[model samples]
Target: MSALGLKIIDESVQQANIWINEVDYRVGLVNKQRAYRLLRAVLHALRDQLTPDTAAHLSAQLPIFVRGIFYEGYNPSSMPAAIRDKDDFIARVVAIFGPEPPEDITGAIGGVFDVLDARLSPGEMAQLRGQMARDIRALFAD
Candidate 1:
């Protein structure tokens, strides 16, 4: 994984945890485990889909975006309250890939997610986790 991708995943995990806590506290809904699983799924998918060159480029740029976010004096703890939906959070993750990823990569990503979503229930985030693991292993076996 690119360093920036890694950092984005790490930051995203932290942000997700904060969101989960807020949801639990405010709405009595706790799904930290599921959230973590989803994050892992997405990160794995991203890593698998990107070429080494793309990954390296993204890794280099991610810190600058992250630093900008920090420079705005944004508190990580407040992320949960600010991000009210999963899609919005995902948009941020997608933004790290730049506005236009290569067409082949974009198609592959769509395929991966489509297969994953079809094979697993949205509530069963872990299902995709295993699939992602299997896919990664298969890719490396080539």
Candidate 2:
């Protein structure tokens, strides 16, 4: 048993770490913090673009800890934000980093998307893609 005496929490932590590590690997980032930033930014951008119901559905598939990250600062009322194109979606993710953003933000975000694709169910991935604009959908392309 973990120090917290909760197997679920331990599993969630492990899963979250695996996710972050995969993102770092895929993005070629040496810094886990940068990987985390990219992951959080990409998740928020995608979450905001999904309807509240769809967002919740996606969240349900996430590890407990990652689910928290997915919902951080989420305002469902403003959801499915009119991010109709890739530029708009990328802009939103970049906005979170302020100035002096990462060198390859798009690639990094794509890494996060890749992690999502590898982890989530194919049906869920398809639903998530269906919610996105064409340009944004290209990021998830194999």
Candidate 3:
């Protein structure tokens, strides 16, 4: 049990750590904080590109803490943004970096997608991928 005596909070933190670690490994980054920032940036970019209901469905499968991160500063009313093609999507992720962007932006995005693929169900992943353009969908591929 955690200090707060909440098993759910403890478990959610554990799960979030597992995800951030996986992202770090996938992105080949030693710094977990960088992995976390990369994860958050990609998630926000992806969420803005998804339909509100689709975004909700995807969020349901996320760890409680990660889901909170995913939805941070989200505005559903203006969502499913006009992000077309891979370049545009990558631009959105890069825009979140605010200077000092990752060396391999596509790899960073794909690293987060890989973590999502490993954590989320195939059905939900398919639904999420269906919302993206074909070029962007390539990042989710094995």
Candidate whose TM-score is highest: 3
> Model 3 misses residue 7 by how many Å?
0.8
Model 3 per-residue lDDT tens digits across residues 1-142 = 4766998998999999999999999889888888888889899999999889999999999999999999999999998899999999999998985677689888888888988888899999888888889999998866
TM-score, structure 1 vs. true:
0.26
**TM per prediction:** 0.26, 0.94, 0.95
**lDDT agreement with native, every candidate:** 0.38, 0.88, 0.89
RMSD of 2: 1.2
Residue-level lDDT tens digits of model 1 in 1-142:
6556786677765654553343233322244443333333334334334344433433343334322332232333432223223343344435543544323433333433443344334543342233333533332211
| Model 2 ranges with Cα > 4 A deviation | none
Q: For residues 1-142, what per-residue lDDT tens digits would candidate 2 score against the true structure?
A: 6968998988899999999899889989878887888888889889988999999999999999999999999999987788979999889999875665578777877888999999999999999988888889888847
For model 1, name the residue pairs that clash: 4-59
Off by over 4 Å in 1: 1-30, 60-142
Give the winner by lDDT: 3
- Who is ahead in TM-score, 1 or 2? 2
In angstroms, the error of model 1 at 10 is 12
Report, for all candidates in order, the number of backbone clashes.
Answer: 1, 0, 0
